[model samples]
Target: MELFFTSLLNGVTYGLLLFMLSSGLTLIFSMMGVLNFAHASFYMLGAYFGYVISSYVGFYPALLLAPLAVGAIGALIERYGMRRAHASGHLAELLFTFGLAFLIEEVVHLVWGKSPVPYRVPPSLDGPLFTLFSATFPTYKAFMMAVSVGMLAALYALLTRTRVGLLVQAALSKPDMVEALGHNVPRLFMLVFGGGVGLAALAGVIGGNAFVTEPGMAAAVGSIVFVVVVVGGLGSITGAFVASLAIGILQTFAVAVDYKLPFFDRVTVSQTAPVLPYLIMVLMLIARPRGLMGTRET
Candidate 1:
């Protein structure tokens, strides 16, 4: 029972992290109609940036400033890099992003080297919050949960309660109409794109230490972020949220279980951990092409 509960909690936590990354990616895709292969690369950038800032300053300030830095980078990329690629169309945009992802990874290697950097939790959040069923749950995990929930709630409120949010949504729903109505959709796109990048960076900031801060970490987990976005449904915030949580739980539980077959006694056991989420993602796509909540085409 304890083990089950432990796995459940871990899953939820992982799901929140997934949400942080995928939510931004979905928003970017929906608004710009571009698939950003570099989204996860930015995530890796966030972790490294957060580590640098936190090392010199402190975690709290790093948490606030790192996302802004990432957002600025996103805006620059959009203004120059993506804008030039935009002339050629979606294929161009995707290729641009893919190339950008590789450049970013190489840059990370050049700047930080190929070694993993350890950024431990802040002193305040270093200790265990409590012991459950003889298992210790670290306070940092709770801090991560709080940050994820807070950010999600803040994003929800912004989208539902603010005029800027309303205008952004309007533009997304009817770009032609919004442009006809005299709103600067281009500028709005920049802001929204930057905002999405910021959110991804923020997730990276908090999650760096929880996972590992390394050069290729973004590429490693990048596919999973894509899967969450697919599972949640493209361009649907609510769908993305649900999918993120679901993926987190799925991965967590997958690692916890020991796979065995009665009739397959001769089959050798794999030494590594579980990996059922990828299989589930494949089946989900095959069975539900639209995903659990996705609606956008192409």
Candidate 2:
């Protein structure tokens, strides 16, 4: 029972991390109607950039600054590159992002080299938050959960309560209408895209130390990020939130087990282990195509 509670808590923590990544991806998709394939690259960049900042200053400042820098880069990409790519079509936008992802990874390798970098947990947060039933939960995980919740709340309030949030929401509903109203829709798009990338980067900064800060980390988490967004439903931040948490829980729980079927316990095999998420996603695509909490498409 204690172990179960521990895994459940761990699952929730992992889910928040997923939320941080998927929330940004969902927003970019909703605002731009173009999949930013390089979203995870920004995440990788955040980790690397945070490492640099951490070396110079401290983890606290690195946590705050790295994402802002990545946001700036994302804005540049949207303003110069994505705007041009948008003219060609959604396919072009996706291809552009894919190319951008490739380039970013290459740049990362160039700067950080091909080897994995060590991003250790901060000494301050390295210890356990508390021990329950002889199980110790790290303080950093609690800090991460707190940060994710804070970020999600900020995002929610911005989208629903603020004027810019309304504009972005309106923009999502009808970009042409928003533009016709004399709003700089393109700039709005760039801002949203930048904001989205920034959120992903923020997740990167925190998660890098918790997980591993490495070039390959992006590729490892990238597809799962997409799955979270897709499962959450396009154009729905609420859905994204729910999905991010759900995927995070699912992934964390999946790794916490060593199980066998009641009847098939004797016939154990590792081949069917890792593909559960894809299977579940496929089921979601088939059943709830728009995803839970998704609004009707315009």
The runs of at least 3 residues in candidate 2 whose Cα sits more than 4 Å from the true structure, single-residue gaps closed, are 255-273
Backbone clashes counted, model 1: 1
Could you tell me every candidate's TM-score relative to the true structure? 0.93, 0.93
lDDT of 1: 0.83
RMSD of 2: 2.1
Residue-level lDDT tens digits of model 2 in 187-284: 99899999999988998998888888888988998898877777778777788778877776666666666676457866333333356557767888
True-vs-predicted CA distance for residue 285, candidate 1, Å: 1.9
31 in model 2: Cα distance from truth in Å? 1.9
- Scored by CA lDDT, what does every candidate get? 0.83, 0.84
Report the lDDT of model 2 for residue 51.
87
